[model samples]
Target: MTRILRSQGFVTALGALVLALVAAIGYLVVFDPARKTVAYCAVMPDAVGLYPGNHVTALGIPIGTVNSVRPEGTGVRVDFEVQEDRALRGEVTATTVSDTLVADRDLAVLGEPGAAPWDRSTCITKTFTPKSISQTLQGFSQLAGQLTGGGNPGEQTRIRDSVVAFEAATSGTGPELNKLITDLGDALRAPDAAIGRIGGLLDSYSRLMSSIALNWDDIEIVLMQATEGIAFINELWSRVVQLIDSLLVILPWLNSIAREYGRPILGALDGALPGLRLLSANVAGLQQLVSMVPPIVQFFEEVIDPATGRPQLTYAAPKVALPRAEADRICAALNGLRPGHCDGAENGLSDVNLVSLVLGTVGAR
Candidate 1:
């Protein structure tokens, strides 16, 4: 009886061991920590504390763990084995976050999310959105450049201009500027000379000023009168502008004066050039006639005795035209009179005839 009991006990112990082994394997299949049940793909610049068999959690609940971490192009690819019921929505951010206490940055997530019913059986890889340190650093650097103005396109040009101008002003280049300082030093040393010169200048200026000040009342009255006259003139000018604009024909008249009359008057002066030449020759001859008078009479009486009728004097032959109305009109026009009006006054033919004036003014070598 004792042997049979021992045998039964041995069989039961063996059966229990088999059952525990089967249970462990079934537990591993259904909730395998490394099998990537309901897996998700996350990208990270570096593999965040995640490696094969690293634990994962959702809302502090142990949901799954990392199954595999592999290099993926520029970044690393990580696979997480999440629980069947755990939810990971689009809004959730996956990043490698760190704490001062932690030796390495941890693979973490935020934004509590929902999962699909079909996601339990196979790997439903929703990409985990991760924070980029490089992008953050780039943004910070760009912002710093903008704030300092040193990175502004033309800021360096402005700084260069200011520095160059400062250097130029401090450098001495001109004699007048050097002498100005020298003169100031001398004047400060010789106070008497400076004071005497200043006094003399001031006295002269004072006398002139006194003369002006003595007539201050009259000056003020004249100034007031001038101001009134100016006001009247401005008012008149304004009215005249209105009237002129109303009479638009005046604009064409002014245009014609500039185009036609202005050039022709200069041409008219050129046309009268021959007459001017003749007048100059006449004046020169008149001067010669006066100088030769005494010599001529003596020659006539001495060389050709009129008492013997032996051709005492040979008359100087000449044909002179009398001044006609047309010639006078031309002369008057040349003399700067109204084109056709000439009273033949002294101004018409004076000590300075038209030819002498024209030749002196316009015909100089």
Candidate 2:
């Protein structure tokens, strides 16, 4: 043992062994095959900035690396390995995202854990590559060209001239334009209510239009009738004009005649007005008189002789004489006096007073 320790060759061999063991340990720790990982392949339409050794991330966290990228038909297939703990599964999607405009792209895997884990046999069919900054700028340039009339010089010139003319026309309207913009902003600030009202209005308008469409035939008939009525009116217009002319021609003569006769007619009516009013005042008494006519005719019929058709007259002496005051009251009542006019007597003749008057008159005769 002492001889071996003193041997320089032995010391060199032992140091070499120790170094090899340390290197082996470091290799195992850094790239251990025991750590499980899942291999997956994704076919992307464009893998422009993606290359081998590119990081594969889940939600911006680096989880694996791209193993290879090669063209397959029209698209590029990307082979990657992800840590088994962060294993991607069914319906997984991959996107190449860049940290910045100048930075290399990363493969981002996105999906929730599914029933089946992904293997190399399972190729991710869904993948996206965002538009590059240059491409986006090129597209914007094309849009701007189109807005400015593209390659047509005449159109461009016309648009430019129109813009200039508009600017000239609106030269000093800054305040007005500002006010319009401010008012528009205010009007649109709470747009939900306005949008709801507009929606309701549109719905009502649609219903109205539908109703109008349904009643189109009736509306057409009404329009036709109105057209005919207008034509009829037009046809009568000349007659109306002629009638008006005739009236105009006769108006002076009518005026002259009215001046001559109107006064006398008015005067006569005025002269008779008092008598007419007096007659109207006694209307109730007149009604009472009219009601008495039927009874009078019936009485005359009862007294008439059938053979002669003439009323038969008879006289008899009174059984009892009526007092002068009672006779006066009876006479006043029979003369159609008002109820209160005949004091201590009814407005109508009583049976007793009527009999007494008749008997007394018969006796006097």
What does candidate 2's lDDT look like per residue over 218-323, in tens digits?
9999997998899889889989999999999899888987899989988999999999898667777877868878999988887998899887976653333335
Task: Write down the TM-score of every candidate.
Answer: 0.27, 0.43
Among all candidates shown, the one with the greatest lDDT: 2
Model 2 scores a C-alpha lDDT of 0.81
Clashing pairs in 2: none
Lowest-sum lDDT 10-residue window in model 1: 345-354
* Model 1 backbone overlap count: 0
Which lDDT tens digits does candidate 1 get at residues 1-365? 67865798878988999999999999998777454356676766667455677666654455666777898787787777566556565455565544443344445654444533333233333334334566678889887665556567766476568789988997766788789999999989999997899999999999999999999999999987998899999999999999989779878888888787978888899999998898677767777758868998887677776578576545542322324535565555555732322334343331224334444457442
Candidate 2: which stretches are off by over 4 Å? Answer: 1-33, 100-103, 113-120, 157-279, 285-365
